[model samples]
Target: MKIYEITFSPTGGTKKVADSLSNELGRDITGVDLSDNNEDLHEFSLKNEDIAIIAVPSYSGRVPATAAERISRIQGNGAKAIIVCVYGNRAYEDTLVELQDIVQKNGFLVVAAVAAIAEHSIAHKYAKDRPDKDDNRLLKEFAAKINEKLKKKDFSTPEIPGNRPYRKAGNAGIVPKPTKACTQCGLCASRCPVGAIDKNNPAKVNRKACISCMRCVSVCPHQARKINGLLLAIVNMMLKKACSIRKECELYI
Candidate 1:
C-alpha cells in the first residue's frame, strides 16, 4: 500500500518526528509539506488500498488553525490513517482527539494515534534536544507494532489522550521579528503563510496575522529573525514549570 506522510511543521521538530516514523516503516512515503508559504492546500485522494501517516504539531494544545483548515480539505476516500500529534514538552491536551475528528470527517478511518515529543519550538529550553535517540527507538517500536497490526488486518480503534471539551485555547505566544542583520531580502515576507510580512520590507510584520509559528525565524538563512528577548524569557519560565524533564512518546492502535 502507498504511504502518505502529511505534516505541518514550522520549526522542524514535528517534521523530525514524522520523518523518523516514516523511515522506520520502510516504505516509499509521499510527503505533503504544509509549511508552504502559499495559500494552496494539498488535495489528497487516498484510496482504500493506501495508508496514511498524518502528522501535525500541537499549537497551545490545539492544532494550528491554518494547518487544521488545510488538512480538512484532504479527501481520504476511506483510507486507513495513522494520526500523529507532535508537541513541545508541555502537553498535547485535546489535539489528538480534535485531529482524529478532523481526519474522520475527511473520510479517513484512524487505525492508530501517536503522541510524540520534540524540542520546544518557542521555549527551546524545554525539551532542548528531543525526538532524541530514545524517541527514535520508541518510534521504531511503534512502527513495528503498526506493521504487525496491519498484517493481521486489525482495525480496532485505540484510546487516544485528550480531554472531551478540550482545555481553553491559550493566547498566541511571542511573535518573531527580523534583526538588524536582516538584508530586507523579502524572503521572510514571501514565505509567510498569512502574508503577515511585507515583501518590500522584511522589517514589517502585521502582528495580527502572525501566528507565532516561528516559520520566518527558522527559514531565515541569515539567522536574522528572532522573538523578543523578554518574551522568550517569560515563556521559558512558564514552560519550565509546566513541562517535566522526563517526557515520553506514546502509541495507540
Candidate 2:
C-alpha cells in the first residue's frame, strides 16, 4: 500500500515530528506539502489501499486555516489516515479533532490520531529542541502500532479529543518584519503558505491575510525577518506557565 506523508509545517518543527513517525511507518513515502501555496492541492489523490499520515502544527490550539483548507481539497478516496497534530509544550487543544474532521470529510478513513510535541515556533525556549530523542522513540512506537493495525486491516476510528464547538481560534498578532539584512530575494513571499507577503517587495506583508505561521522568518536565509521584541516578550510571559512543563506524545487508536 502507498504511504502518503502530508504535512503543513511552517517552521519545520511539525515536519520533524512527522518525519520521525513516517520513517518508522515505512519506506518510499510520498510527501504532500500542505504548506506550499504554489502547488495545486486538488491534484493530490489517494486510493483505498493507501495510508496517509496527515500532520499539521497547532496554531493557537486550532487547525491552521490555510492547512485545513488545503487538506480539504485532497481526494482521499477512502484511504486509511493517521491524523497527527504537533504543538509546542503548551497544548494542542482542538487541533487534532479539527484535523480529524477535515480529513474525514475529505474521504479519508481515520484509523489513528497522535498529538506530538515539537519546539515552539515563536517562543524558542518552550519545548526547545523537541521531537527530541525521547519524542522520536515514542513516535516510533506509535508507528509500530499503526503498522500492525494496518496489517490486521483494522480501520476503527479512534476516539478523538476536543469539544464539539471548538474554541474560537486565537489571533497570533505577531508578524515578522524585514530587518536591515533583508535582501529582497522574494524567497519569503514565494514561500509564504498564505501568500501574505508580496513577491516583488518581500518587506510588504498583508497583516490581515497573514496567519502568523512564521514561515517567512524560518525560511529567510539572511535571518532578516523578526518579530517585534516587545510583543514577543509579552507572548513569552503569557505562555510561560503553560509551556514550562514538558509535554509528551499521545496516541489514540
Candidate number of the best TM-score:
2
TM-score list, all predictions: 0.95, 0.98
For model 2, residues 74-170, the per-residue Cα lDDT tens digits are 9899999999999998989999999988999999999999999988899999999998899889999999999999899999998999977898989
| TM-score, cand. 2 | 0.98
Clashing residue pairs found in predicted model 2: none
> Which candidate ranks first by lDDT, i.e. highest?
2
Cα RMSD of all models vs. native, in order, equals 1.4, 0.8
Tens digit per residue, CA lDDT, model 1, 1-253: 7888889887889889888888877669988877775635545688987888889999899888877888887889889889999998888989999899889999998999999998888877788899999999999999889888888988777888788787777657567888789998877887776788888878877887888888898789999999989888888777777786667999988
Model 2: lowest-lDDT 10 consecutive positions: 36-45
Q: How far does residue 121 in candidate 2 sit from its true spot (Å)?
A: 0.7
